[model samples]
Target: MKDIEVNELKERLDNNEEFVFIDVREEYEYEDDNLGAWNIPLAQLPYKLKELESHIDEEIVIHCRTGARSGNAKQFLENKGFKKVRNVLGGIVAYRNLEEEE
Candidate 1:
């Protein structure tokens, strides 16, 4: 269970890196702000696991409002045998802070 800083995640996004990026926040939270990640909503992750089956062995990055939810999501995915699961440190809050810093 590796953790990725928001800076590295932003660089990857800028470079068009290919990976499974998931936002585990609820729909309303996502609608307010997001990184264009696939919205899986932590509560519904179990039901949507199949949708992510193909990416089980790939790099999967998960984030939430403040990283707590995404941390749980990362643990859950790893427990389910996902080979590479990374949680964005500080989640979107840090991500936005990075944006503001620039």
Candidate 2:
């Protein structure tokens, strides 16, 4: 699976690049903070696959609190035939840290 760093993702967003961003963390975690991504927790991924079928060929970024869960999500989407799935390295934690640093 491909890995995307927080800085790179921020740059892409700043550039207004089109991509599907999915947050694989729990609802409460996302409620606290997020990257304005679609909330589809890891446990709900399988059942929600259909909702993302049209994005199978699009650039899709998956993230959780940390990279682990999103790594799994990347693999799962790949297995399901997604062509451009990427896991946000260090996930939201790193993203937030980068924001703080900036």
Candidate 3:
């Protein structure tokens, strides 16, 4: 699977590009901080797959506190036939670090 850097993801969001930015962390972790992502915890991903049916073929960027959960999520989506799935390397921690550097 492909991986996206934090800066690239930020640029896409800044440009208002259409893509699915999924937060795979639990609710509390998400409440701590998130990059303007859709609330879809990893636990609920299977049940919520239908909700994202339309985006199956779209660019999907999955993230969590670390990259672990999102990595699993990305694999799951790929197994289910998602065309373009990616994990944001190092997850939000990396993203936050990038933001701090800028």
Top candidate by lDDT = 1
| Top model number, TM-score | 1
Question: How would you encode candidate 3's per-residue C-alpha lDDT over 1-102 as one tens digit per residue?
Answer: 578988898899889998889999999998988778998999899999888898977899999887999999999999999979999888999888888998
TM-score of each: 0.97, 0.96, 0.94
TM-score of 3: 0.94
Clash count of each predicted structure = 0, 0, 0
Predictions in order: lDDT:
0.94, 0.93, 0.90
Record all residue pairs in model 1 with backbone atoms less than 3 Å apart, i.e. clashing.
none
lDDT of 1 by residue, 1-102 (tens): 679999999999999999999999999999999899999999999998888889999999999988999999999988898979999999999999999999
Q: How far does residue 7 in candidate 2 sit from its true spot (Å)? A: 0.5
Cand. 1 Cα-lDDT? 0.94
Taking the tens digit of each residue's C-alpha lDDT, what string does model 2 give over 17-70?
Answer: 999999999999999998899999999999998899989889999999989999
